[model samples]
Target: METVMGNGNGQATSGGRAANAPHSDLVLPYGDQRNDGVVQVSFTLPVAAGPLAEEAARQTMKLMGLEDPQVAEATAIGEEFTFFVGYGKLTRAVELSKLRVAAPMWEELDQAAVNQLVQDTLGRPMVVVGAATGSDAHTVGLDAILNYKGFAGNRGLEAYSAFKVVNMGSQVPNEELVAKARELGADAILVSQVVTERNVHLANLTNLVELLEAEGLRDQVVLVVGGPRITHALAIELGYDAGFGPSTRPQDVASYLAQEVSRRMLN
Candidate 1:
């Protein structure tokens, strides 16, 4: 993706343009530097929708180093609350090259390798139970990961020769998921939640962890959560082994599961 990074004066470390020049179409040299001067900011503050509110929003943008901030749109989210979409040019650029995120990085193996790994490591097929738990009705994300066909260009977990994946579909309750895991002797539990409104997903995730802890299955099974807003930090806080957010690839999940299972066996 193309990105632009610059200082307040339009001067940037990027091999090109001023930090604030109208706009620059340059792909960030590094992941950290790719600050595509675009953002979808939303805020709810107690203010009336008027010139004063617009000015306040613009001022907020300026304070954030957004030059010539423009209030593109404004509306009322609820009683005594106002929302604004401010547009502006950012003066700061990120040093993309300095970023070092911890994540699985490996080429995906074919069906044969997967099957061989399962047979050699687990002495049988690796069983994984997945579901879109909580009140979330969206099944597309879970289906994309657990179904054999997969999503995008990546193959789903079920397509792996070594994996015996069972997708329980969506809207599964926590207790039911736990029961299913126990019944199926699942080695891993993959939970997906896409809805975040009112923090319902958080409650659901927390409950699942509690259930696992109560059942003495917390350490025995690899617990993973994924969603549009889920993060590794949040997952860890909720007692999950790992958390995945939007744009997570199937190979990434598969590699992590394979490595983690192997690691656990050693201990």
Candidate 2:
């Protein structure tokens, strides 16, 4: 496969990679491994579904650099709105070899290992206080990690033998979370923020960190945040010890907490 250079605008330049490369260097859109450059996209338009609306959708896709744009499906949404699914050929090929992402540093552990680590290292039950704080009322992420039922078939922190989990549910205040953690002598603090409207989660998360710092408890506990938009890098940037993203299993959190608590205690 030939190597390709992107212009920083996602457009490939004339270049070549190693001819005997083990993996693909440049890749185009593939439908059923046909490599037809076929692309499917869906969007909504203000106009109602009709002949003009279909043309507008096609033209919009064309304007975005798609070739042979076709409005495969169109539906009228309420009165003045129309939704469309379009298919076209993408002209550019992406260089997968050039991609990079922030990688996680924590090693995951199983249920037994996590429990044993806390018991052997800490010599006591690790207290954890978790909540979905601020005006964000979403508790799905918090419940999944703290609740006994867990998420994705993994047992939660409450089910672990070594961690005492305190779930504060939804709409908890930052100050209250800090107070509760202090009151419980928590070894870890987990915050879940699902509502990112206008970057409200950022402010809410930052406020919690600031509150902990003000209370002189910021370095006393393992702090973690989780949400669909949350990333490890973002969590560290917001002064969190770690961040768990969507589809995180309970063992993932339990392992991190056990290791982090032990590390902090030893340090």
Candidate 3:
């Protein structure tokens, strides 16, 4: 059975979460002390709220392999629905050695530096087209990176002098985005996917890649994707050159584009 969370759009999932599960070079969640394996988990059950629901939640934690399960809170949401917040300790930890790590010796350039780099490399403004493609209606992420006002006080791509940006807004079709990129001879394409329900972002992003390939324009542009759940590794797997997740500043992406476009031009 699926559990709804956060605006009733998210479905609670379980995988044994190998990334967080214990293995070699164990790493455990810390709440009070290091390696305490303390964790807080929240979920909803179809049982009515009360003492029974809290007990059920604690047992559920035990079934999840959590030790010392404590049902912190239980509240009734519906006639037969109860939301629970539980605290527990895991008997295991995640292995650090199995993860990918990178240490790039490059710094994110400022807006001025980004413009200078583009001017120095291409001798003209770089055309970059961006959109919240497919049925993704959330434009906050896209606007934050592309609008001149920026996000969290950092300036955006539109503020960069060397960038010719065309933000196509939200719900843009994959074909329309490709056509716009081709139409503008874009040097880069930035796609934002805020909706990932049931891994829809994966299919949408993959379709964009296929479209770019079909149009024979994949090699001609730097493809970038960003969102809350996006990762560089996942983006690479989806055929994107780069991916920016949550809390990524616009300058960070601008620096990457500056460096990538510059390197491509020199090549």
Candidate 4:
């Protein structure tokens, strides 16, 4: 006898239960029933909200592989922009067990532990210089990691006695960031890019790498990037040590730096 359980979809599926254990194989976007393939998407178009705009939204959804697309809501923003919410069937399944991602191998330690490790191993404060570089003038992400008052009430790197943090603020150029990092003899460089329009972040980040390599400083420091769209794999591909996404706390970055510094310099 197999016991049934309610998955994200409202269906009570045994799902090939073995010893009362649910199988983790193929998965679909659940709406109200198992394998229903329901999904909701939101987007903005540069057209005013009206009957034509509603039709456009539905047609766009269809082009995106959605079937039986229904425009749930359409609203006009100011005068020229239209925001749309649409629902449809995705009809796609992915093997959850087959998917792979780059996972962090280091352990995250608290402020005291990190400080002690740095002091005992390096005998000096680890210097980190961070900024929001390029035309991306957003500083919220950079500030959250470097400012003493961190995001979500977590203490920033400044709280760690073994770290010397220098937050260069927003709109810093790649040249200046690299120069400052070189000047400070920084052990790590953190860059936050919020604007990803036309994949500009890629260009900016790559340019920084090229500059660092030209200056012969690429291998000497840990380079990390963070933003809403960044991922660990993407960062590694773009010549960075690591990447962080939204809601990343200061402690998270600090802990990674501590372990990474020890790994790079101590060992």
Candidate 5:
């Protein structure tokens, strides 16, 4: 792969061909670049489309320490307001290589190993109840993890011989999920939320945790929450045993769930 410089402006100096490198050979441009605090942000201002609106957008970016902000796109949103999309070169980049994030560190284990461990230790299948709880009606995420066929070439929880997985589908109320878990003698409860607008998912997730704690089931079951925006740190802070984010593979959840179950049993 050949490397080309990006014009001090955001555009690539060479043709588009120079920027589209294959993932295997791609190199970081900021490998040794110093960190700067300048940043670029884009949002719609509830103002008319004209010189004044453009000036307001630039001023907002300037306040955020962004220099030479350019309004790349603007559109009329309504009769009175316009939506503006801007791009600015941010002078900031964090030292990601030096950052440390705390999370569960478990050895990867396959479905067979996970099942065998459950049978050997718990003497029964690991019961799990999963649902896309709250007002979020998306079921694809939960189905991908609980169904037997699975996603991305890895088998899901239903494929494990020692795992009894029940998927309750989407838009399930939190009270119903807790009731089902108790009825099924579940060892773990997996909650999926995809609708995040207005932090609705956050409130729903917190509500589930609060409900489980009220019912004295918070510690009895491994409570895991997953979504496109959910992070492990966010989940831990929200009183979950673990959190899986977008692009998470089936084996990642399986490995974590199996290890958590075993750990709980031992304790």
Candidate 6:
């Protein structure tokens, strides 16, 4: 029933928009009814689970600009921790057209096309060195992109004749990955890691870049990173050429490598 100035686009002055307003990319959280702006949120507080804790949760939601915050449940997790679930009506709308999202612009190619492109451009299989660098022992993400079996019914780079994949499994040091990439004359290097608390992987990913730069291989190799926590924007911010997040298929990586290597060689 009320409106406020919102973030992004600056046109979202109506979290609960008028019933007859012309729709032009304005959006809000929907719950029981259209334009209701109802949202559910769950969070844990350091206070003990009691009436005070429940009230604190409601107050927190109100502080977040939620109207009519209704605390649904409060449970104790530990000696001094309480978890609360609540419903609230947000009073801010977002203009979708003004949102800036960072993503890669590349043409999708199938396995056959990728293979043909590699053949036509390099006249040899593209060497790809992949590993789960640092103390991150997660290999499921790396294996899905580099292994022959692939993931989600799509064949990985190993199955593509265009790519010669050397998958160095989990817990590999950044030094080892760089060395392996150099030893094999890899055209691309993929590092996978699970992002941890305080973004511990940030140091490791940056360290890898530093190593590559020091080795005189940064410009020659296409550096890519992947994991559940990885994003194209984040990877680039960390000095990687590309980044793959969860649900990315092997074909996506292969196509990028094929096109990137081809483009570099051509230029």
User: lDDT for each of the candidates?
Assistant: 0.75, 0.83, 0.85, 0.84, 0.77, 0.85
Q: Tens-digit lDDT track for model 4 on 1-267?
A: 123343332123333422322564667777898768899999998888899889999999999999999999999998888999999998778764454446333466888988988888689999999999999899988888888888899988887888899999999999999999999999999999999999999999999999999999999998999999988768878888888888888888887788788877655
Can you write out model 6's per-residue Cα lDDT over 1-267, one digit (the tens) per residue? 122343343122333434554674677788998678999999999999998998999999999899999999898998899998999998788776565555554568988999999999999998999999888888888999999999999998999999888999999999888889989999999999875668889999999999999999999998999999888778888898788888999988998899888888888
Q: List the residue pairs that clash in candidate 5.
A: none
Residue range with the least summed lDDT across 10 consecutive positions in model 3: 1-10
Question: Least accurate stretch of 10 residues (summed lDDT) in model 1?
Answer: 1-10
Q: Return whichever of 2 and 6 wins on lDDT.
A: 6
Candidate 6 residue pairs that clash: none
Clashes of 2: 2
What ranges in model 6 sit over 4 Å off? 1-22, 78-80
Q: What TM-scores do the predictions have? A: 0.71, 0.85, 0.83, 0.78, 0.71, 0.84
Cα RMSDs, all models: 8.7, 6.7, 8.6, 8.2, 10.1, 7.0
Candidate 2 deviates by what RMSD? 6.7
Error of 3 at 31 (Å): 1.7
So what's the TM-score on candidate 6? 0.84
Better of 4 and 5 by TM-score: 4
Per-residue alpha-carbon lDDT of model 5 for 133-234, expressed as tens digits?
888889888888889988888888888987888999999999999999999988999999999999998899999999999999998998998989987678
lDDT of 2: 0.83
Tens-place lDDT per residue, model 3, 108-218, is: 677789899999999899999999999999999999999999899998999999899999999999999999999999999999999999999999999999999999999
Name the lDDT of candidate 4: 0.84
Task: Identify the candidate with maximal TM-score.
Answer: 2
Each candidate's number of clashing pairs is 7, 2, 1, 0, 0, 0
